[model samples]
Target: MKTSNGRKLSHAALSLTVLGALLGAAPDSHALGTQGACQDNHIPVALAPGLPADQEVFARLCLPPGQTPATVQLLIHGITYSHLHWDFPDPTGHTQRYSYVSAALDAGFATLAMDRIGSGKSSHPPGATVSIDSNAYVVHQVVQALRAGQVAGPSGAVGFQKVVLVGHSYGSFTSWYEASDYRDVDGVILSGVSHTIQLTSPLRVLVPLYPAALDPAFFGQGYDLTYMTTQPGTRYGAFYAPGQADPAVVALDERTKGTVTDTEFSPFAVILARPLDIRVPVLLVNGAEDRIFCGPTLSGTVCSSAEALIAAEKPRLGAQVPCVEAFVLPGAGHDLNTILDAQQWFAVAQSWMTRRIGAGADQTPGCGP
Candidate 1:
């Protein structure tokens, strides 16, 4: 079946058992194991103007054992990351505690973690062809496919009556546009992002990003100069907080890092300037020490406490928003998934979802009285 934009959605899956063994994951209901059905899918999406049509978006869809879920969380990674952002495979054989995907599955929610059009296993159009707007368009199509049962799985075509967008960093920016423009999703969970930000902090990321082709990680990978990645040995400083992140996770992150396009970087001011009219339940999460958006003074958000962060963001979201919430992961940085206490925030999100949106697909997403 064709998506709302008139493009067909295509998908493929690998053997779940084989995938589990390869990633050192075991079969467990509370872990990203082989018990549940999981597939790596390539979904066709139309790109922005002047780009090729029918570009495929790569996603990993995992449903819980015994029954299909009525509600699904569509995971979008930050720049320089992949679907792994949501399901970080623990290199130490302790995968049970680290993955947000696993936690959601254990809570009876399906999860679809996807790579944006220009990153990970997805189609890499010219870097100039990718932007926050274009990425948002792709996400909207994916949401429609999920709701329409156009995304095929091992059992057959599967659809969710409710979809919640879960985004981190740049993914949160894309979610902002999608939730505002399409207003199709049931809920949104945004992390590592806020309307207020430390203006000078972005230089810490931009200064280190050279052409991905030149980075030893992407050498001979055929990326254009517009495809950007951090210099080697820079992930720890740029994305994680010292002494709060695991070194092993940082190493794995560097080894599997993704790219960001130049086009994705140029539209920040315009996007923030546009008014948002999202009418669903919106949750904002950030690391207490997020170097990009947290600071000591009022230049950016005061992430010292959750209440403070909520106060900082509430005014920016406008009175039109019905229900908005915030959480701050203490001692963590921008990359919340790989930090020491990552699961703490994951639990917070899960609990919040249950309270606001509930588990039933027919449940309307809003603030509970």
Candidate 2:
């Protein structure tokens, strides 16, 4: 009887040792910021009215645990950014720090972070073929796919009851166009942007944008002069807030920065003149110290605060938008998600999302007459 008991104990010990070994070899699920509780899928979507021949846009779709989320955020990155802009990698190896994806998931919302047609893994058509109008059409198709369950992820065809279009900088411009023309999204969140470019002229000096072909990093990408990027050591000043962003994070920004097409620039010049016809709830958020839009460069203007900036923009948006809310993060810069108060920005966005898009139990208070 003693020998049998000894044998059984030995067998159990061996099984435990093997299990530990297997667990050690497994990839860290927490690296994805959800402790392996969520789903991440790489989605390939074809764009219509694209740069001819149907260009393909790649995106990363992240879904929270349990049942599908009621609202999905389609995140559009700004100039010189990709899907990574939404899910920034923490240089300190802390998965819980400074990730918009983690914040959205915690707030019970799914995220679809897409690379623009001329950036990241998406098909890079000729620079001239990629414009604000073309990108707006691309965004419209993506929204349609989300509503119709046409976007197939690893978890199978995924659809959402409500789709919110979120954008930063140039992406905000495109989102504005999408909501204005298609009026398909349930809500729109425009970050790192303002209606005016009065103080942004210095950007030409700060960002010495040269042809991507001239840069050694993009040797064989077939880039023309129209595809441009900032010179090295320029992004830190142009995007990050003074003494707010981590050096390592700034380095990552330089390494992963993408291209901006010439055609994308022309649209910005005319945006202030064009009237926006959006009928959905619109939220505009920017950094308090955003040098690009709200700086001292404007000769005959004063935008010392968020209220002043929003008031300046009210006329360009027309009187059609249902509810237009604005917030300015203190001490943040153009890249609000990478600065010291990044989590604060995320929390504000999620709170606003819950209030406006039905992500939480609370219903949206109507825009009263």
Candidate 3:
């Protein structure tokens, strides 16, 4: 009868912009292709789909250098991408040419990348439940698995050092949840979540205002259709492409429509209540032209918590930004891997992680203006 997917206007705008703006905003467009030379630093680990179900998932571990460190940095992946997404060829999978994982390895830091669980090699958890909480548990188990030698991590640090979880989008939610779940973490990094989180109206409610053309073009042919009839979890993650859902991972978009209350959920919002309780520094990273959050450069900030983090090329509406060190990479979109020299961003990230993990300080403490 009616289309349920909302953001029809924004979707139409972004669909048109995806070709020229999203891909063209960067100066290093050529580097996005294979010609850019993707360098693999070093991530020695195996893939585990998931526990109980025994699905195949992807993960890579980087051992600490000569000296055993005391802390570890866990890199949480964003929506739709596997653990490999942020490392090499970029998390966005926009291109294999630029991989942040490669840069992290080259920088000589201990890190781990994990496939959420079901979307990758891992089997789906029972009840087909893919909630953010479930993803956090998966990350928790994965960390244990890493320590157990099922996956690898910083050597020497062992059980002594703090574990910092860096998350993006849904991945950030996992990290946010991790901060509350685990006690050993040293810090958490949130990018793309400048501030508060607001839930969108359910598809069932939005269908009346549905824009047919926008659905196929925006969500792509297969996913939009599936979501239209099959319901969300049929493919699991609707945040990005279906079937690519990391069984071990979950996003706000994953659960049943309106099942979780906004107060009950929201990674950034979760961080606020326990901001002082966390006792860890948080770094927030975002793109000046982030289409998804900012509504294709549309008015209003991508997130509600714009006050806490330091703003880069935008205005803050009295949010608590000073607490969050915000950085904006010019011209970058949601594509973490394909953005810029990919390696450079990773190098920068490595610096941040290194500083937090006792490797060193971020050469550039500030992000963008």
Candidate 3 has its poorest 10 consecutive residues by lDDT at 1-10
Candidate 2 lDDT over residue span 1-369, tens digit each: 000000111323333432433443322222343421333333344444533435677666677767777688999998878877886655544344567877998888888888887987777888897888778888888888788887654457767778898999888888888989998888888888776654555454335678888887678988888988888888877777453887766776777778888888755568646678888887788887776766443443224565766676656665788777788787777788877688887988898888778763245433433
lDDT of 1 at 331: 78
TM-score of each: 0.88, 0.84, 0.54
Instruction: Output the number of the TM-score-best candidate.
Output: 1
lDDT of 3 by residue, 1-369 (tens): 011111111223333432333343311211221211221112222222343533344454444335433444576765434554453322223333354544554555456655564333233333224556666676776566544544323222233234567777667766766665654455667664443333431231223323222432224422221122223443232232211222322221222111121221334334433432334556666554444443322345543233323443223212322234455555554444444434544555666666544543323222233
lDDT of 3 at 169: 65
Across 1-369, the per-residue lDDT of candidate 1 in tens digits comes to 322111111111223422453454432222343336676677888885455557989877788776787888999998888887787756544454568887887777888899998998888988887888889999998999899987865567789889999999999888888988888988899899877667777686788788898887678877899999888889999989643876766776787789999888766667667777677788989998888878555543578777787777666665667888889887788888888788898998898878887767667777877
Clash totals in order: 0, 0, 45
TM-score of 2: 0.84
**Candidate 1 off by > 4 Å:** 1-35, 49-52, 295-300
In terms of lDDT, model 2 sits at 0.71
> Tell me, what's the RMSD of every candidate?
5.5, 9.6, 13.2
Ranking by lDDT: 1, 2, 3
| lDDT of each candidate versus the true structure | 0.78, 0.71, 0.42
Cα error, residue 5 of model 2, in Å, equals: 45
